[model samples]
Target: MSDVNVIPDMIADPSAFEDDAAFRLKAAQAAIRRECGWHVMPNTALSGVINTRGGSVIRLPARHVTSIESLTDRDGNKLAYAYDPETGLVESLSGGFPAGIAAIRYEIHAGYDDAPDVQSVLISAAKRAGMSPVGLVTSQSTNGSSASFDVVSLMQAEKDKLKPYRLGGLP
Candidate 1:
């Protein structure tokens, strides 16, 4: 709930920084990580059968997955699995996700699990690239209470830091 940044703060404010305050942490983390992902927290983990396409590895739930807390089946039995913490690839230990009715469910904590040294880099990025700016206030509705902010994308410098952990292992 608190971890979800599903909404872009039109009233952008990273000043609202709390360790767990909001998605800014991951927005920053995502920016630092420079990849797409589910970014799951304890409460937000999704449950479902991830089709393995007749293989041992299940496609990562998102652009990235930080950790796999557990894997289970429809019977609610825990299944053994392995994964690359870097690439988010999970493979069945005993066998594949199995070739039958979709039954495997996942409980993963996805996203950049660690903090980068340059959080400010990400915060600055959010203000500049994370949000969109309104071009020319056409009406000026005089809403009494007003707010303003800018959004920015992850800078090339910032992205470079995450390259080692990046998929394809780009150097």
Candidate 2:
């Protein structure tokens, strides 16, 4: 994902914008991720303590949590626990975690693995973002009322790809 040139398809034609394709593609990827609320990565982290949903089920706020290293109480004292790698739910094999704020501690490696359809999201975002001089600006709206070139280029279908990765509920 470092070099946007490797992305199979971008909204803008590679031929049309020649030199700026890579830059635009990269920008689009970042923008789409921000809009989608997928900030997880293997090295990144998402942590929380169980309060109401107490017992073995730990609430992990992020997606793609790979592993849980250690569980600790509010005092940072290490505790024994087991976590399911697939579901990211940690089970207290030893006992139950205290129901409180930040009562349990576990270091987790979390991040988005980029779904199979992620390429489509990138391409859609790239199409509307990174306007090169190639596109002619016939009508420019100062008040920003539907005539914006960016708005015209963006299609609802492209934004739809980001629905699955949304942070909480409908935005």
Query: Number of backbone collisions per candidate, in order?
Result: 10, 3
Encode model 2's per-residue lDDT on 44-135: one tens digit a residue.
Answer: 75565544345756645555667666567878887666765555456676666667766776676776565656666677656655454444
Best-fitting candidate, measured by lDDT? 2
Off by over 4 Å in 1: 1-34, 40-49, 62-68, 84-87, 99-103, 110-113, 127-151, 165-171
TM-score of every model versus the real structure: 0.48, 0.50
Top TM-score model: 2
Evaluated at residue 134, the lDDT of candidate 1 is 43
After aligning candidate 2 to the native by TM-score, how far in Å is the CA of 80 from where it should be? 2.6
Superposed Cα deviation of residue 19, candidate 1 (Å): 22
